[model samples]
Target: MKNVVLRASSMTQSGKYLLRSIQNESMPKIDLLIRECLQNSLDAAVSRNKGEKVFVDIQVGSCETKKINALFDGLTKELNKRFTSVTVDYISLRDSNTVGLTGPLKEEDIKEEGNYGNLRKLVYDFGQPQVEENSGGSWGIGKTVCYRIGIGIVIYYSKIKLAGNKFESRLAAMLIEDETSPKSLLRSAGLKNGNTSKGIAWWGNEDINGSSYPITDEDEIAAILKDLQIQAYTADETGTTIIIPYIDQQALEINANPYGTLQGKLKDYIGLAVQRWYFPRLYNKEYEFGAYLEFTINGYKIRGTKIRPYFQEMQKLYNITTKAILNDNQNVEKPSDIYIAAIDMNSTFSDGRTAGFVAYKKYNEAELSMLPPNNEPQPYTLLLRDDDDDDTGNMPVIAYCRQAGMVINYEINSAWTHGLPKLTEGEFLLGFFQPNGKKRLRKPDGMSGIEITLDEYLRSTERADHSNWEDKEVYGKKQRIIEKIQKNLPKKIAATYEESAEERKAKADQSLQRNLGKAFLPPSGFGKAAPVRPKTPGKPPATPVFKTHNLSFKLEDMSFSDNGSVCVPFSMTVKNGLDNIHLYLKAHTSQQEIDPGTWEKDIGSNFPAVVLYENLELYLGKVAYTSVEPVYSSKHVCYGIHISQLDSCYNAKGKITLQGKLYFKHNDPTISIRVVAEEGDR
Candidate 1:
């Protein structure tokens, strides 16, 4: 224990360092712990067919320190010593039906190039490389997590099942601190080995030189546990249980959740963190042993039926995931069990051409209302590889991954805005780009999951994204992966935002004003069968009223709108009650509506005394409207006789209102010289 350090000069520094190593963009330290722990269990299960049923249990206990006996005085190396008593908390993790830590008892037993047992893989080494394909953690740092749980005091007891009906038990303690002299090594634990290993301690009576090896003898194991008043391993079971003698007091205070009537304890929040991040691996068909989780702190417990309510609360995510898998990422499609999206992204060095469906899930606003408080939409873009358990809820709004399913970087949804259409507030997008695992079948979606796959990337972080979600830098040789994704994925998803023709029309012209009344002003009455401008031009611009042969007409007022509607006010008096009066409007240039012609003989018989054309009968008192709803004065219209009732029009160009044509409903609906409005007797 000379060069090596075990105990921290500061607990906060040690705790923070351990936390930072396991933390992810989307999860808290506790969540990262749960995910890493259960995933390790799953990887262990995959080692055997029957071990697939992985049920992991967690127990948190708070107890006051009992007088620790047998402490060796630094100078004399004698036992029969005591230490100060303090209230300590502990958490234990027990996984059933697992191949417990059964392997080399010491570093000497390990080989240069061969298989090792969990015991050595965990205790004897720090940062030991894992041999399993699906196993997690970077450099075996995860194994030390238990030791970092409290004031750095953790003991491991494993009951291993051997061949036939045999079983062996192993007990060891691991502690780390500042290096000390051989005679006075406070950071030391486990077998003394006469002067050999000082890190791991085993059960057995001390030998001549004060060194003790593991007590493999079954009777000895039982007698030792019985003597210490500790629980003995059951005869029929085999698994590993980790014990933390002292938990971090500051960690509890810092991570405790303040939400409900009862302030959530640190351990209770950790239990919730487990539920948030590990549910993906734990959810099952209820009866089956897919994955089991349990957490307890003090009097409170997150075990058995208690997890149901928490689990059920995440049902909204299932619905979203269901859409991605079965309905082609749309709610309208008939749901199918499988969904696939092919991705094809290629940088000069790396190629990402894989077919898979993008999976996305988030707690929507409606779902958040159902939960009591604190809990909100937990959005996670599930790419292939995500190694974390911290449920602190800091996540990349959009996660970018590679073919192996490892998320290289967790990115924010806004990061894509530079290359795509702008997104509105309250709108979120999460996509899971997964490569097909089975027969390399062609899929369009999963093809381009990775952007920059530089050969020299992350020599230290085990291909994990080291930067937090908000950190943005042009990565790789020349902004390779990030640039490539921005060049394509945004354009594709943006196309889905297009609107239909009917939808456009409904939104643009829902009001009557937009649907302007249509009127066609065709020509008539010419020597060439064209319009005839009658010789009825009387008064000049200075005169307000003009007299025709039969009646008096006055140009009251005229108005035109930028939106193509026109309004005109005209007054006509024919002495007695005027005959049928109607307003005709047509949309024309500043010029004319019809060509006029003179009265000709037989050759130009097409010219009539009057000609006929298409004209609309306007509703009384209504002119073109400025607003959606027409506002009119009842007193504005001539008595009894109707003038016009015009709301806003939808015509490309609103119809033009002609000079007031006063005409009685004769045999035809054309302008008649006799009924034309003329000046009154005044």
Candidate 2:
């Protein structure tokens, strides 16, 4: 058989670029692996029948060491050390429901664009540029992750549905062990060579024309796979399954990802990594930018079951995108909330990518509804990270993706952060940027924001993350886009937006004070003398409603009076003391004697306060003056609290209690006094 030893120079250069070169931190090596392989799969994916998402299976299984018997005559002596310690453990990542690798096995001698020669290119070439728009890996360095995963070795197997109803299968392997030493014998699985360097090992017989193809005989192929201790593709499957053998536990350990670790095992870590990286595609219910689903890691589906626990959090993020964060049209009906804008721009000044994209939804800290902490409290926070403070979830950088739904980068670097708007008052932002794949997506004419044609010029560094783009134009454009969003979205979101962390705390405290809760008071000790009636029974006792404030009250406000004798609006809370009783302030004096300063109600200038509590609303409670003349009082102040809207007092069994305050409008000074209780012991 003719030997096909690849040029040593080309091999060395590719190996250096992919494995030997330390471009960035090694912890993300696996992430790079996941990103690239999956990107390729999705690019070649097709709906099962008409409209269905693609399915991927990332499996971890083992084989017996004796099974892999591929050997060379003189090479065995030199390769013994290399092959001796290799565990039969392997990770078989396969993607089904896709258009199987359907292309010529080899590139034609004459160069052409649509050569359909993927199998040959993937098996033989390195750093080959992909002409497809939605294709990933601008530098093709991502494929080197396979070599990095193991001791520099990778295998490929594909099952293709050819013309008519026929099917075809092929297999290839790449080995990148350093060849600097004389004893080192690095070889790949390819054509069997009795002459020259052992290069290609064909699963099938060579054609009459000397062209190699996979062994079509299922029995032969199966036996060969079993012999080599390699995973086999399913007969009915019509896609690709990659086997990363000699699983490198040491490699994974040496990387030591302190942040994103999963159990200590590489296999376990892989599962978590998959969920973290590909969650968006799996949770794509909108079916707009991404259509990936049914992800399984080590046989566990990442959708509703294995990843079910994270769904609530993922949904919190997903809902923001599907339902806009700021879209508020009634008829044509925009999404619930979103800040839309054109993302397209110039390539001359920016990174050289053609600008185009649609639909960007902001998850500005508040919109995420309170993410969980990444540290530990049962469920993890978003992306399983509690960076920054380590107790709270970090605001993720906007996840930017190509049109094919393949994530290019998560904008997590300083370069990206420097360009983004600074979060104020604990306000951060996360926007999902979905660039249109060379399509012009127009915003609805009735929509409030401008059209979104985002120009995403990701002139990325070797890290594959566009973290270090110094292009003034690209940064300038992106900054301008963010500035515009900041200027517009808040105004619209202010209408129905969820309260920020600080606001939530204030509102909750306010509600707690105003709403009377069930009393949990300690049992009173038995007393020998039980008074039939206390002295001065008609007089209401003066007791502070809450420790925080002492409020002056009319005795009539405490009693169930049919006449309009009292109007008191106040918030009271109690702790430390268990006086589990509900009491009201009564007017100790007559209505005329208890007269308050009267002022004309003017809403625009100085209107009555609108005291809003969760359970009750004392419209006039916020006003400085208790009584306002007819023409002066705002409707709120005139109405006062409805019978249903009186302030309720509650106290917990603790050393904390709250008191109320009565403010005079003209002087604006508060009158501090204990609330007068009704006749009851309460």
Query: In order, what lDDT does every prediction score?
Result: 0.39, 0.43
How big is the positional error of residue 527 in model 1, measured in Å on the Cα after superposition? 68
TM-score for each candidate, following the candidate numbering? 0.51, 0.56
lDDT per residue for candidate 2 within 438-520, as digits (tens), equals: 32323334545533223233322224432232322332232343333333333333333445879856754443333212211
Candidate 1 residue spans exceeding 4 A from truth? 1-29, 46-51, 67-87, 178-232, 256-263, 285-340, 346-352, 361-363, 369-396, 399-495, 498-682
Deviation from native of the Cα of residue 626 in model 2, angstroms: 54
lDDT of 1 by residue, 163-230 (tens): 79787898655544222335323433332333333332332333444433344666655654443334
What does candidate 1 score on TM?
0.51
RMSD of 2: 16.2
